[model samples]
Target chain A: MISFFNVSKVYPNGVKALQGVSLQIEKGEFVFIVGPSGAGKSTLIKLIFREELPTKGQIYINGRSILRMKRRDVPYLRRQIGMVFQDFRLLPDRTVYENVAFAMQVVGAKRSEIKKRVPEVLKMVGLEKRMDDYPLQLSGGEQQRTAIARALVNNPSTIIADEPTGNLDINTSWEIMECFQEINDKGTTIIIATHAKEIVDSMRQRVIGLERGKIVRDEHRGVYANATT
Target chain B: MSTGVYMQMLLLRQAYYIFQEVGRSLIRNSLLNFAAVGTTAISLFVLGVGVLLVINTNEIAKTIESDIEIMVYMRHNLAEEDALTLEPLIDNISGVQETTFISRDEALKSLVKQFGDEVEESVGEENPLPDTIKVKISDPREVNKIAAEIEDLPGVESVRYGGQDFVKKLFSLTNWVRIIGLLLITLLGFCGIFLIATTTRLTIFARRREINIMKYVGATDWFVRWPFLLEGIILGFFGALLAVGVLYFSYGALIAKIQETISFLPLVNSSAVLFRIFEGLLAIGIVMGAVGSTFSVRRYLRV
Candidate 1:
């Protein structure tokens, strides 16, 4: 569902984040994009969401060129894809339910639909009982779960998570990974960019490795190899 | 439901959400919003009072101008019949409203009233007061021209009126008052807008994370903008209402006392003037609120 052709990104300060990268991922595939810091993993993910434009090539999502899309159409594109971040960007003042319901409200979902779906999504993340609690009132893992619940409440076709477990303990990281596994099992495509070598090796999914702004390896049922070659 | 009905329902739902967001933010940043509203109220209040002052000053100027009268003194040795003939000539002047002939005897009577019975007895039967034609003009500003025309008329000695310099000074003073009042209102209006804009900018900056989250969730630009715009309008409107209430009671009491003690001073009718000022203040308040928020929130809504 995503294709990048000869994509290159160079910052104004002369740092080349990505250079001549090309890749394709089919729908309904849970893929891991593995790389070290400054290895173009985040830049690749940002390009998919049109957060930053490719400097030298076209990126397509579902047969449409995102590089050619009008500025106003970006929001509709975002609505079809959910995003999770390492920080669990929940409004501290709002309750868990509000945090999740906010996503649906942004898409103008009916009040009834939001009421029906928020609890179901929270249940999937295992936080249904704490829906009334604010983000600050929850543990780190629980807060991450609430963010995941918010991401899922939109019922998007794809989920792009940027280091979703970077701040969590190893145990909490496994739990968050399990939540992603459950979501993937239900047929939503998942793309994760991460540095967690153990989780990457254990998942045994399609892995694309990046090194020095270039994709060094693409393997099916891959292991997280340390060397660039 | 029909499509039109469905659309209306959607609009109503959206309005409810926007207003709910406005209420939430208002409470969230109550202190800042309170200061914004208070500044707006004071600005509008000062503007309203300045407008009323200008209106009343104009009214007073008009009253004074209307009371101006020209005195056409007849020649000292002119016959009584000849002096009476000058009445129609004075009345026919372009600016003259009307002219009344005051006989020597009537002039002597007014003189005696001013100088007492000793003067009356001293001039008994020898009435030395000149026969005069009292002239009222349509416009006080036209007094110099009409007085000059009457001075050249036959059987007239001199034309006398109140201080021309003083009349000119009154007109210039009122003009300056109006100009300065308008300038102050404009300056205060911009000050209020600036304060509101800064307050809104700070509030939006504080909630920028929430806004970023909203953008990531695919909220449309207008969806994000509506609540902030409504917040500004509500603050502005509430401030204006407070100012209007204060102006109505205080100005009414002050005008009442002024009228009681200084009965001759001309003041504009308070109720109608206050009502007009209230409407103007509300309009200015709402516009300032909307405009201030619109400009302040623009830079942060790049998403």
Candidate 2:
């Protein structure tokens, strides 16, 4: 479960990125955070991982306030939430298998667990064939899928995909979404931040839309509502 | 398997992977790594040799000073019984190791042998060298004090032990050698740190993409950190090994030849001193690598 109570972020440069935004998502739910560039979508996701602290209001991940968490404790919180970036964020030198295993390795998963889980997750993301291939060798879609596989290796409670398919073609982007759908069906909570209208319309999930650092819409089955509003 | 056992296996595997990554990175960036190592080895080699010289110089000086003896020249008209009685008194002095009475005749013969046949014949009838009591001090530094005490004794004409001027000059020389050695070591240490830091910084810079990926993927600070630290350790160890090898062989040859030519220098046994230096080099290299990597990575890990 994730909850943000009246959260606001004001960066030191006098930019108030997110203001008085409050929202909650139940466990095992898939949600979309839709916003334009500089609309505070990234800032909200960053808060979940303690990358940036909200200047106002408290953030609770499973009832634990992370706003006051110690610096060292940030890693433990991160271990429970897997994150994927728009760039795929895979180590260039590592093979697909290594990239996925790296997440488990950071959490100190056993060698047997890693060996067992890495291939399983890679197969789930349809990257089993490219397990030996490096990120540079993989296509944008394949790299993003690998990134998704890496995020799931630790079996995190929540998966946060920040523009996970930003660089993929329409079909490949849907395929990446289907992988998320399949992952979601398996009871892992999924939260995605994206600007893709087709993605929001097709997913028919609870959507939280932000405009200029304020939440403009929250719907059980939203449709990039701010653009239409 | 137990949770603890499983956790340990995972940590070890992660550490191994990190070490492997570090090794591959070092090899991939071999040119820079080699530069790091080469600079460190040269600096350590110079530092080790300088320290070795200072240590040995002090040792040899102490040995020489402690072995010195004072000669007390007797009055020409002194009675033999009184001279003989004074011998035991002089021998009983606190730092006096032994006292040998050299008769005027024997002293003349030694002088003759040293100055050659011409001088020997010239002083044959009249003994130019005085009948002296040669007092070997247990500690050479006490020679002047003992000489001063002997000068006031009955039946003693003069005390001919070397004075403070020679000791002052020797001490001054020793001090300068130590200062120079220390200065060189300090300078070399600074240069070594800078070289290793720059090499590590460049390596990390080149791999910034990978580091960024790791950070985004929920990798802990330690998870991202271990590989760089291990890389530094490997570089340091390799450099130290090369330096030790070069220094050991060079010191062995030079010390052997120098000891043979100038036996009085008391050059420390190279084989023995080499082991100590080797240990120090190992410590320095590892610490340098770890510290340098830690320093360079912390800046970019922020944010």
Candidate 3:
């Protein structure tokens, strides 16, 4: 679980990305943070990862104050949470298998451990047959699946993605969402920041809307647009 | 296995992985790597030549310095015996190695011996040359100081040890060579570092996405640093080897062909000295590479 207490972030060049916004995300919840471009959606997610600290306020994850975390503990902090990006960010030269195994290798897992975990995660993402295929050789959905597999390989407690389907078509976007839904069913906390209006409307999950760095709505089973507000 | 041993084993395996990564990167970006290595070799080679020049010039200066003898001329009005008595005073000076008294007639005799008896016939009865003492110094660097002390002595008119201007010129040529050589070498070192750093920065820039993925996946900054550091050292090693190889053989050949022409100038001929220089150049090249990599890779390894 993560909590932000009156967090406000003002960038160095006098840009206010987020201001006085506070929220709590419990364990095993699927939440979508929705907004147009430059609305602090990405900035809020970045604060969770501690990539950029909140300019003023405290953030806590799992009852520990992430705001007070020391610099050397950053890797251990990141290791507990998986991250996916819009770009997929896979090493173009590596195979699907190597790309996933790379995550385990970076955290110093033994070869035997990597060998066992990589295949299991790849199979879970439905990419077991394309283990040796390169990223350029895969479809958009398959590549996103590979990215998800890599994010999941390290067994993070929560998986946060930023615009994961931004580059995909409608069909491909739905498939990627289904992939997230399947992941969510496994009881992992899933937080996605997206601009996909139809997917948010149809999925009917918890939705938090932001406009100009302030959260205006938070509701369970919410629609993309509020019918009455 | 014990825990310590197991940890050591794991670290060894990790080091091997880093080395493999370095090899893969080097081959993956061969053209850019070749350019970095080429610049390192050329800069270090020029540096090696500068060092050798400094060493040889110092040796030449020392040989010439030791051979110089100061002539302390007696006053024209002084009796030859009175001037001869001043030889002990000249010899007593602290840096004065030895002094020999030469009467005017002996000076004339040597001159006559050189120019034949016609010089004695043209001079008639009187020898125009004054009685003088030839003074040798213990340390060439102390010549000016010793000459001043000898000039203040009674019965001494002037000291001529190669004109004052000639000695000043020689000192400038020898002493300034070292300071100038050091400055040039330092500048060349910066050039080599800049080349390596720029090249490594380009490669780091190209693979930034990979680095971002590594950071997101919980890879420590050191895990990313290991490969780049090794790649830099490898580039540096090959460059230094090339420079040392060229300098060693070329210096040996130069000595063989030119030693007789400048027989008195020590010429830095010994293999021991050359090997020492080669070792220094190799060490310098490797340090330059390591420093270059450290500077460029730090910005990309935030985590």
Candidate 4:
């Protein structure tokens, strides 16, 4: 579970990105953080990862206040939260298998555990047949799936997808969303930051809408509200 | 298996992977790796020659130190027993190589032979020169101690030895050679580090998307750091080995030719000394490789 209490962030240049925002995201929940181009959507995700600190207020992940967490403790926090980007971010030179294996190897996982986990996760993403293929050889959707497999290999409690389908076609975008939904159903919290109005409207999941760094509306079944609001 | 064996196996695997990665990357960027290896070889060769010169100069100084002599002049009334007893005691000193006792007649004859016609006719039947004991020291620095002890001996009139000015000069020369060698090697090492750092940075830059992805997937700093660090270390170790090996062979050949040309001269035996120097060079190469990679990787890992 993640919680934010009156969290505010002011950049070094004195631009306030978030203003006293408070929200609670429970375990096994699927939510979308939607906003216009500059409406603190990225800031909110960065806060959860502790990549950027709040200027004021407390932020908690699993009941631990991360605002005062040390630099050395950041990795452990990251291990609990998996992240995916719009760009597939698969290593061009590494095979799909090596890329997935790398994620586990970095955490000092045992060889036997890695051997078992990597293939299992690749199979989960339906990329078991393409394990030896490099990222360049795979299609855009397949590459994103490979990335998602890498994320799932660690079994993170929360999966943060920042514009995961921004570059995919409409059909492929839905396919990616389906993958996220399946993972969320399996008891992992999912927070996807996107501007895809159709995606948010189609899911009818919890939606937190942002405008000019302020939460204007939040609904359990929000519509594709216009940014003109 | 025991814990020790497990750890050993783990380390061996890590080492193997590190080298495999290095070899693969080197082949991928063969041109750049070659440039790095060439630069290291030239720098090491210059550093090696400087070290050789310093070693040979020190050997020369040792030879000069052993040949230095001091003379103790005895009084005209010195007794045979006292003089005989003094000879044994002086010979027992640590630095005393050997000693020759000369009587007045023998001293006069040596002076006549040295001065030639001038002393031959001027010195009549009676000898004018005092009998002195000439002492050779194994170490020149101990000359002063021997002279002081001899001066305090019974029937000793005066003790004379050459000034320490020559020995001090030799020491300064040898020290200068060492400083030059150290400075050249340090400068070469710095160059090697810069090259490795730049190479590693470029390699990282080329695969930046991969790094960005790793960051998204929640890779730790060290997790992100390992492959790049390993990459640099591999580059450094191989470059150093190549440079050191080439220098050993080429320098060995050169030294052999020089020895053959001047076998009559008491030049330092390059054959025996080269092995010791080759070992030292190998150690320097490893350090340079390791250190160069470390400096190169630290900056890129900042993110």
| Model 1 C-alpha lDDT per residue in residues A58-108, reported as the tens digit of each score | 899978899889878888888878999999999998899999998988777
**Against the native chain B, what TM-score does each candidate's chain B reach?**
0.92, 0.86, 0.83, 0.70
Clashing pairs in 4: none
Per-residue lDDT over A105-215 for candidate 3, one digit per residue giving the tens place of the 0 to 100 score: 888788888899999999998999999999999998899999999999888989999999999999999998998999999988999999999999999999999889989
Interface RMSD of 4: 3.3
Report the lDDT tens digits of candidate 2 across residue range B4-67. Answer: 9877876887888787787789779989888888988887778778778888888877776766
Better of 1 and 2 by DockQ: 1
Please compute DockQ, using alpha carbons, for every candidate against the native two-chain complex. 0.60, 0.55, 0.60, 0.39
What RMSD does model 2 have? 3.3
Comparing 3 with 4 on DockQ, the higher-scoring candidate is 3
> Alpha-carbon error at B62 in model 3, in Å?
2.6
The C-alpha stretches of model 1 lying farther than 4 A from their native spots are: A5-22, A52-57, A63-72, A208-228, B1-3, B79-98, B113-117
> Could you arrange the candidates by TM-score from highest to lowest?
3, 1, 2, 4
Which ten contiguous residues of candidate 2 chain B have the minimum total lDDT? B121-130
Per-residue error (Å), model 3, residue A23 = 1.2
**DockQ (C-alpha) of model 2?**
0.55
Model 2, span A36-57: residue lDDT tens: 8999999999998788899999
| TM-score, A chain, model 3 | 0.98
